[model samples]
Target: MTPAPAGRDPDARASLPLLLDAVLGVGSEPELQATLQHIVDSATELCAARYGALGVVDPERVRLTGLYTAGMTEAERAALPELPDGRTGLPGALISDPRPLMPQDLSKDSRAAGLPPGHPLMRSYLGVPIRVHTEVFGHLHLAGKEGGGPFTDQDLALLRVLASQAGTAIGNARLYETARRRERWIEGAAAVTTTLLAGRPAADALMCVAERARLLADAAAGVVLQPTPEGGMEIVAASTHGDPGDLVGTTIAPGSAVLGQLLGGEPVFIEDSATDPRMTTPVRERFGPSMMLPLQSGGRLIGTLALPRPRGGRPYDAVDRLLASQFASQAALALVLADAQHDREQLAVYEDRDRIARDLHDLVVQRLFATEMMLESTKKRAAAAPAGDTVGEDTVGEDLARAVDELDSTIQEVRTAIFALQQPPSDAPTTFRGRVLRETGGAAVLLGFQPSVQFTGAVDTLLPEPVAGDLLAALRAALAAAHRRSEVTSIEVAVDATPARVRLTVTDDGRTTSGTRGTTRTWESAL
Candidate 1:
């Protein structure tokens, strides 16, 4: 069609070539928001309109998401009750069927009558949809001619060309953004796999997953929940920016839809956990979007990895869900591999311990027993010697008896060491209180019943090693003395370590009525 006469557009038509050049060049703006804003500004300048707004449509085509306005003061825009929902008014027509229109008067249009209370007055209107390829992304709406006349045909034609270029710029910006986001997610998944394979503890492996996933997804919190014996799931590890004492130990019951799916090794995605009927946990109320992925590999279900965003945070897009799911799979494989490595290392340790235990029993115990036998024979010979030599023989016998006692004690200790070495590594004691429990538990085999042991304060951390060793010796002596008594029934041991001192009291019902034979032993040491 022919353009409007020079009499109408006059000076405005002269700048149309430069305007097209500028609009087409906005694709290199690099930033998505800036590129979009520049497009709106270019449209207003090219059309010579007093007010301009670029309404961004939501992905679902439900409503306008954001407004990029030009030629309006910040205060004026802020005073408005709410931004325009472009899909509801005159602009909605463009979204339904994108096309250019320059209405003679908007006040006569019924759809433009329901303006918010603080809206500005306008008459002439021009609008066009900004399409990204085939999708109607949104519309550029302008009103009221700048020079106080109608929008000529030349002005409408100019906007259509600018709209085409704006679409290209917007599309390129989005592609760039998606690429950068995907890069971060890929790197994050790789980091988690590397960490899990580094032979850390099982707990640490889970924690590495939680921390990395939280950062990658930009969620409020990340948690790894392991199945409990009760057919439910309990949070074993949690990663949060602040205090996480409450996140750990949270449980998802057996019957919830989300929990059931996760337990069965299926993934769950919720747009709004706070309102989703399938989410039954109270923690869901604090989150909007969420993803629950099962960590399974080789037909074994490890657990569920959950990432939850804050109550109003943006929902995850298709790309986000896909990347996160793939990350979860890689993480699960890493966890299984890490667990196997740990088991192998532990097996090697146990084998070495068994060899050491055998050497102690076979060599050390035999030698000590042989030496004790020789001492016993020498003592027998001394006791039988004649009266003139009685003095020397008695002295010789006394020395031999003490040596025999020492050898017997050494043999008993070696036997206990062998028993300890033969037990699983988990059974080993890393704390003083644990060692004391080990001692009492061993004594139960001979006592025919278990002893009740009670601890108060931080005995394991606060008690010194030497003082603890002395207490153990006293406890052994008392228990051994009680075992020799007639009809010993029960034993109770208590260790109370305060800031001032550590005290141990061993009381037994087996204490004989003859006080000289058995007694309650109390051992105390100053801190």
Candidate 2:
């Protein structure tokens, strides 16, 4: 196309370059907020107006929820009693119709509601709605024409061009921002899963989820609540900039409206927790917009994850809700997998204990018992030697008796160990016989092997409390004495209980201080 003569269309020649520059200026900013502000600034400059603002429309409420302005000083803004909500005057008219508004004089326009108190005055008005695809994103307002003249049709046309380009720039910025936000949430979920599966304790794992979610959601607090036996939900973990003690342990009662939904595994989103009738917890008044998401995996409800912002904080949008729910689902699955791994680890430990017990019983105990029998036969033969044979022979017989007693003690110690290894690691034995076995089991660690244990005639039933206490005390003293002996090799513990009496016999093949080998100590008490 041939260009029009500059001399004939001087206004067009001057305005076309300014319009192109303004379009490039608005699209240059990649950030959403920066892009919006730049559009407002460019429009005010292009229209030669002293003031300009962009009012963002909330589709749900059909109201201006946010405002970005240019050419207004900080002091001037601070002096104003309140900002406009785009619900009255020309701004409201523009929003209702989504069409351009250009009045020759604002005072003559019926839609004018007059300037707000302490706000700058003088008005040659121009307003235009900005569109992104098919939706009206917001409207741009310009007032106080710089040359003290009313905005002309030429100025309005220039602004329309700028607004159209601004829409495309805003759309691209929004898409970029959404992609970045989704990336952050995904990374947070992956971090939580890695931490949970790293063998963190259950409490720590719950806390990790809360902390990570709070950071990603930009919430004031993050909390995890588990179902109680009473069918209520109690906060078990909390993450917040402030002390979380107040949040932890807060409960939603069984009959509470929110609790019912949470227990049923449904998510609850509250516009303002402080004012929501469904919120009944004492701590609810401290929060504003909140999301309570159910943490569940395969129909098993693990808990609830709650992210609550401070009162009057920004409300979560549709994108925020969608990302958070996805995080919750992933976190729940990780929790279940971690729990299963922990159970498998415990089973492996138990199996190892069983193997050790079997080895002691089937191999060590049998060999020790056979040795004890062989020693007993040797002692008997030596005792039958002639008394007049020699002093050396007498010494040999005494040593043989000690050897036989030591073998018997060694066999008993191995048996005690086998029994101890068979008991559950977490459960403490309550019965008196079990308690006696426990004591001997403890001594085995220091003794390098288990001590022998024998329970005669219903020891757990027949032994009285007082008798059992005293017998245990005497048994401890005897074991200590045996441990003190340098040559101590084995200990035999025998607990005999009857209807009338109980006797605890402790014998060790340890040499006494007086050089005598084989020591026997007995504690007797009446039932």
Candidate 3:
């Protein structure tokens, strides 16, 4: 290749071939770090600077992220002070302002005041804002021009053009990084869900989710909240190795602290928990950055997930929030599913018990009724027999009558046993009116007296489940009360069903010493 012409147009000199080569050179970057390094190197060479630094801006564009750098030894770079977060220095100001800044002497600039302990080699500097459209992505600073002079307008323009290219590359790299992170999070969430759904109990599943969240987010601690019976949150599980035994079992009231905010279905972010106004307890003193995200299932708030970092750690950003929130959502769903499974199991047990009760009632009650009829027939025969065929025959008749009495007592014992067996289980079905009535009968027997229940109209067929359940419960209560009184002789239960409603009446004929001796309690419920 022949020597290039001297004093060529600077724009033309740095354009086309050089830019295309630089862009194409980064195509082989297999990872995000490699891609970022390639871009920084390209930026340095394109601007012809002795030193170059590229800092990725945070989501709010108020902080610099240490990702990649070029043209400095490890020790030299380590010796340099940390870069300012916001639009503090000339470089950050340019990035924030999204404009080219060509400072003749950066060391003397007013904005360069209060430099931290040991800053890198910098003098005449040209800073360009790396931006994609209107959004500023980061800052690119070219320090100490090798030719020894202040950066000219042409240099500023050239840097801006090169910055544009860097912006595109940086944007692509960031996008790639974001997508990879998202993929990893998605896979992690799926794994956690599988682990949770594999019959893990609620506490264990919550702990797994916390561990996975801490690992994925690289957080110092992770906590999971579950709603308690009192509408508060209990920290059921947590990963707090950095400060173990600190946050576990902590009860946070609903809407009281950061955790409460999350449980109330709002995400809470505290850049510094130690100083945040929302932090109400002394426990926050150990943590700096923290995020609380709600865990919900079927639109119902299950609890919260609180992820916190150490006091000196960097603040959490949008990416952290997104990842943590997604994890919380998965954990919420798992918790809800586990709870539902438990409920279903309990219901099944109740159903089984109810079935057994029904079987006993059907088999035992029929036998007792038959026995009662036999006793009635025997009593009739004993009365109908002649006064006395003989004195010895009278003795025989007395023995027969005693035998019938014994049989009657045995029938009463069987009835009592059947009543004891018919008690309703805790989770018994609330729908079936017949089932309810049978349970009411058992309850009545315990109080005393076998209530004579008569269904006047199709009571069971007309009433809805809720109404029927309530009516039956009320009737059972009324009958129990009547049997409790010593004066009550007989209980008569009547259920009347109409098109619009069902009415239940429980009456007892008991002798009141001073008044008309009858007590009636009636309940009417809509279908």
Candidate 4:
């Protein structure tokens, strides 16, 4: 027998305007979720079911994307651990088959065994597939008709109508959400480029990308990793809503399965970071649902951009993956261009410094030398006529000597300044090793011999700033003291920054004014 029209039955006619309003009123909802909730409520009321739910399957089509339910209290929803994802058994039949289904007495259905432990015992079911265009998006499952009777054909008919309209509303909502996400990511990319090209330092440029990406992706932490010279990856920059120390400087050792792919400019997705075999870093234990996207431009891999959410966080969907990857590519290109700009700016600075050095040597030093020569000549003449002259020849000689000493000191200072200007701005001593080497190299000229320098352990990476400053100052003092001693022919400098302490030893084979032998000075500081 055929089902009667909902409009013909007196009771169904009363609900006709409501059902039609639920369909036509969909356009009134500016937010897709509100419209969907309204549809679910209308379906439950029309069919006289205790519960109604719309399950949206993920694009992978393997599981439920999300579940929106009606007729359940907040307490009931909260007691559940997480939403179901196609493990609903018989009701899932509609999901797989994309057809209308109405079943009573679920215990008899073997497939109902997959139902969750705490799910309310549901009986007398009605379900219909929600489709978008030709594709099945998900299914709507309604259960437990009120008034104690089996659901008639009329209830199934009304549910189908709502399911049909639900498909259209859900599709529009998804499109709007995707567009918003794309807008955010694109804006993030533009922001990154703008901030990087504004002449910030290299480290700051990387951080800008991290901060913006973390906000856009709503991740717990955003980290930027670069391939190390030691055939590994190092976290060079990170942005976090909490403490960043743990996230920064984390390393992925060589021979890592994940690093290999990342270095090759491929993206890696992790469902659960704490358990994923490919994630070997210690930080992985704190996060889940991670995306590691390579930042590459012009066939050169700059680094990997990783955004990981806290444990049990929502998984990244297809749109998230795509937009984040695109952002990474754009960020990489901006980084490359920013670095080039920095190099060009440095070149200009170097050229200006070189010109200044030339001017100092050609004009200032030459003039100072000429004055010294004139002063020396006057001193010599004064000394030659000293014995017979009544004029204060002693005073004249002392004045000329003092003038020559001052001029020599001035020239030495000017020469030192010019030497300083010669070193490239980029090569300035920023690390402990570089600073130590610079000090020794600068002293070599005064000693007329290069100092033999040796290092033990990671001096550059392990040495702290305060100790490094103290050590460098002492080294300069020792070198200057050595220059004053007579017969200084050789010098040696050693810096051993061990795990527990930093030790510095300097030895010079130079005799003091007293006929003493070589001298050795040692300094130590706890790390």
Top-scoring candidate (lDDT): 2
| Candidate 2 per-residue lDDT over residues 128-198, each given as its tens digit | 99999999999999999987999988898899999999999999998988999999999999999999988
Each candidate's number of clashing pairs is 0, 4, 0, 0
Best-first order by TM-score: 2, 4, 1, 3
**For candidate 1, lDDT tens digit of each residue in 1-527?**
88787667555657767676767767768888898888878788778889988988876636776789988898998889977776567767766667887778887787675577688889988998888999888888988788777787777777887888888888999899788888998898888888877777788899999999999999899999999999989999999999878889989898877777888899998888999999887777888989988899998999999999998676776778888898888899989998887787688667757766776778667767777777777767776877789777777777677776667556555555544443345344669888778778777877788888999999988988888878876776666655656777888899999999999998887646465433577989999
Estimated TM-score for each candidate: 0.65, 0.73, 0.63, 0.69
What are the Cα lDDT values of the candidates?
Answer: 0.80, 0.85, 0.71, 0.81
Q: Estimate the lDDT of model 3.
A: 0.71
lDDT score, candidate 4, position 159: 76
lDDT for each residue of candidate 3 in 9-35, tens digit (9 for 90 to 100): 756665656666766765556466786
Question: Which parts of model 2 have CA positions greater than 4 angstroms off?
Answer: 1-9, 114-116, 379-527
Clashing pairs in 2: 412-452, 413-450, 413-451, 413-452
Top TM-score model: 2
What root-mean-square deviation over C-alphas does model 4 reach? 15.3
